[model samples]
Target: MTRVISILFWLSLAAVLAFITLPLLVVVAASFSPTATVTFQPFEWTFRWYGDLLSNRWLDPFLTSLKIATVVAATSGVLGLLAAYCIVYERLPGSDVLMSYLLSPLSVPQIVKGVAIVLFLSMIGFQGFLGTPALIAAHVVLALPFVTRMVATSLANFDANLDRAAQILGAGKLQRIRHVLLPMIKPGVLSGVTFAFIISFNNIPLSVFLVRPGDSTLPITVINYLEYSLDPVMAAVNVASMAFILVVIFLFEKIGGFSAQIHGGSK
Candidate 1:
């Protein structure tokens, strides 16, 4: 019975993995397909669709999305670090309430936020700033809650004894935080930054409401293209974008030791 249960567990896990990965695999395959339609036949593979992605229609939005995601990641990291420090390390008055308020965005629907932001901007006579500026600000709002939560979790799990030891050794507040707290919680910060990038880059509903006429994001552009046509170029765009995201994640892992943190060995 034990062996049977173990076999079933493995089979169930395999099925879940397949369910998650099958669509991505199909998209990857479609990117290389010689014809517009996706197929599994080995002979139908070609790289022409990738070459077609060099045009301005795709490159413009790709650059815009990259810029937005990068800015969002950096901004979220800074704000999240500060918020986590105040809430978890300092334990300010009503810290729990403040933390809950910061994360309240997570509970609100993003579409509602986007629409409300648009209306608010219109009311304040800031309609001219509705494109990239609005999108970046809105994306930051969307990402801030996750960033705060992740950083707060890391701070909560940190060893306060280490900070006290640093203080006893004559380390100033800034010195201890710089040498101890930041290093220990880096994994969480990096994870939050990566999440910010992914959220900002892939956001559609919010971007749809916030984006200007000429400056749509890559995801929005791809969706709009789909309205006109369906082709392997869309698949190529998706596969290429996914590869870029993978590269970003790989770089973050190298710098942050996310795997080490997972194994409870991060320094």
Candidate 2:
């Protein structure tokens, strides 16, 4: 019965993997197709759709999205670290209430938040912020709760004896935090940053309301283009986006020493 259960588990895992991967495979194949309508003819495949990505039509939005995502990631990481430190490490008065407030955004639907932001901005006559400024703010808000939660979890799991030991050894509060606490939670911080970047880069619902003409994000631009036509170029764009996300994750993993951390944990 144990063997049978193990076999079932493996089969379920394979099924889940296939379900997630097959669509990405199809998108990759479609990107290589020679025509607008995806074809399976390998001999007819061309790189022309990818070449189109070099044009300003695509490049501008890509750059805008990159800039916004970078800003959002950095901003969210710093803010999250600080908030987590206060709530979990310092354990300030009313910490539970403060934490609930910080994480309130998570309970709200993104679409509702997006709409509320738009409405609030309009009412306040900050229409000028409708472009990049609004996008950055909205993305940061959307990403903050996740980042804070992750960092808080990391801090909660931290061994307090280490901090006490450092204190006993004459380490200042800032020194211990900078050297010990930061290094210990580096993985969770990087993971949160990476997640923030990806979400900001690919967000559509929030972006749609915030983006102005000629100041759109890559995801918004791709979606707008889709309204006009169904083309292989869209597939190529998706494939490139996935590749960029992978590269970002790889860079984060390197910075966080994730492999070394895993090895240390195993030991």
Candidate 3:
């Protein structure tokens, strides 16, 4: 009876997951709809929306988002990794307090952060937003906390003996890291990069605040398209965006073995 119940529970969960992902499936299904009203049936199909996405307006923002997200992920990943290393391995003065402060942004509302950034920039007569760089800054800020926490968690189980062993073996600091330390915490570094990149890419709040005209990211482009009309094209765009996201995650997993990082298990 217990085994039967467990199987039933798992089946129910699988059904629930399928239900939740139905919208994405529907969006993909509708992207090829022939009519203006997108439906999931034996309907007319066409790839016109995919063709429309080729225009510079859509193409530009997609490129901008990619560039910004890449830079932000790199910046936040390195900074967060460094901070995690210091907090976990180094006995720096006031390290605990500093870690708390660095991670404090996670507690603050995104709206508050955006407003604060906007205000600060405005006060300084710095109006460089609505471009790739501003989005990079926003993505960096948004992703920093997640990267720091992920790296820190990996660090928690780290062995101090590894560092001692490296030093005793006459390995220098860079060599110790390259040869001994990095391989052990490789999962954390990979996790930090994935978490940072995904969170930054999906974030809309900070992007909305900082984005300037002609410099909109993909989400902003979606909103702008929605404001002008309600068409099945929206569904197609949604599906394309989803595909883009899945591609990024798939590549991350392919390159770094995403499961180990996320599940805290051995490779």
Model number with the top TM-score: 1
lDDT (tens digit, per residue) of candidate 2 on 49-146:
89988999889999999999999999999999999999999999999999999999999988999999999999999999998999999999999999
Checking candidate 1 for backbone clashes, the offending pairs are none
lDDT of 3 by residue, 44-92 (tens): 6799988888888778988877777888889998999899988877758
- What's the alpha carbon RMSD for model 2? 2.8
What TM-score would each prediction reach against the true structure?
0.92, 0.91, 0.88
Q: lDDT for each of the candidates? A: 0.90, 0.90, 0.80
Q: Write one digit per residue (lDDT tens) for candidate 1, span 36-140.
A: 676555655688989989999899999999999999989988999899899999999999899999999999898999899999999999999988999999999
Model 1 has how many clashing residue pairs? 0
What order do you get sorting by TM-score, best first? 1, 2, 3
Stretches of candidate 1 above 4 Å error? Answer: 1-17, 40-43, 265-267
- True-structure lDDT of candidate 3: 0.80
